[model samples]
Target: MTSDEEAFRRMVRGSEAAFAELFDRHSGAVYRYSWGLAESRDEVADIVQETFLVLWRRRKEIRLAGHSVLPWLLVCCRNTAYNHNRARRRSPAGELTEPKPGTHAWHRRVEQEQAVEELAWVREEIAALPDTERRLCDLCLIEGLSYDEAASALGISPSAARKRIQRARGKLRAAKTANL
Candidate 1:
């Protein structure tokens, strides 16, 4: 088998086969990474597709420090997923520019609205959690504190914090599933 570096070099030289080989090697991983980042199935597909598109566009500019290209691909996937999610969050439903809410479009729009409502309901539930669990969630999840930081502030071990967080997440997940 050719080295990943060699295939990448060929891809930079405009060899389509080299690109295809690289894509075949990495697309599954890219998709999984995107999905792990909380993208919907369709959005995960879009992120994977966009990651590859960015890779292809940057083939000439991408610099590989070692023999492995997988790290670069994973970074690209992470970045693409983050950007995609940020854009989605930034665009509230009311900002949608779609002209007409036709049959299929209206259905999709309603689904999106429901999803937004579901998210709001979940937030309310999180806020209603018992004191310690709620503090853990607010510190770690809402305030974006690291587990260590949140644990330290809460006077608990990191493991204990993790367990509480997991428990909290389970409650939220169960609520979501029961609704579904």
Candidate 2:
């Protein structure tokens, strides 16, 4: 079986079959994820379609988050849903009604937005790190690789990987605390 990375490479080269295979493999997950953010079934469907279309359009520019593209696709789906909701808000007909303040839905939306903001902050901090530390964080933290696995991939000792990840965590913690 071709790995998603390999399939993605083929898709980047304009292989429609590889693109279709990727869509087949990931669209269901994207749809379910969209449902969480979309206001209705029809909106979820539109978000899912838009997400994949954006992927196809930007295939040459996207980098896989690990061995797979699912993570990237999920982020794309989220952004598309956000855009869809924003457009609805601006529409003259006002298709999207704002959830009442203090309501459960409003609270949930606030929590979700906060989570997204924190994730973006962490990503920015990781990007600002030294090259080796950034790659280690990407593999061991974001990609969920075991220390030994990440160490092997980076050609470092497992203990060294552990220490670097610990240092990275400290830096991230301090940065976040400073922001707070």
Candidate 3:
């Protein structure tokens, strides 16, 4: 079986089959995630389509640091649902079913928004880091490499790599406190 990375590389090179294969493998999960966030069947359909459209358009930008693309797809799903909600809010209110503020449905919506916000905030924080630090983060956090493995890959000692990761965590903490 081809790794997703290899299939994605083919996708970037304009292989429709590779893209379809990926879609087949993951669209069900994305749909379920979207359905949980969306209030309507139509909205759920839109979110799933938007998520895959993004995955296709941003093929080169995808950095599937892990074996599965599921996490990234979930992030895309959250972002698409958030965008859809914002657009719906800005547009004229349609005859739609929205949950009461204190209801379970409302809590699910809140949770979905929070997930999107958290992912965006993390991306922003990581992007603010120095290039080397960001690369280390992509390797260690996103790519799921051990500190020792990432260190060797980057020509650094394991301790140094670990220290950099620690610093990255400190930065996140500082940013979180500042935001609070």
**lDDT scores of the candidates, listed in order:** 0.83, 0.87, 0.84
Better of 1 and 2 by lDDT: 2
Candidate with the greatest lDDT versus the true structure: 2
lDDT (10s digit) by residue, model 1, range 1-180: 578999899889876656866887889888778899845465888888888888889999999978878889889988888888888788744543663666788788889999999878977898788889988876766556799899998999999999999999999889879888
- As a TM-score, model 1 comes out at 0.51
Question: For each candidate, what TM-score against the reference?
Answer: 0.51, 0.54, 0.53
Off by over 4 Å in 2: 1-50, 53-94
Ranked candidates, highest TM-score first: 2, 3, 1
Worst 10 residues of 1 by lDDT: 92-101
User: Could you list the CA RMSD of all candidates, in the order they appear?
Assistant: 16.3, 10.9, 11.6
Task: List candidate 3 segments past 4 Å from native.
Answer: 1-7, 10-95
Winner on lDDT (1 vs 3): 3
What's the TM for model 3?
0.53
The runs of at least 3 residues in candidate 1 whose Cα sits more than 4 Å from the true structure, single-residue gaps closed, are 93-180
Alpha carbon lDDT at 99, candidate 3: 91
- As for lDDT, the candidate ahead, 2 or 3, is 2
Backbone clash count for every predicted candidate, in the order shown: 0, 0, 0
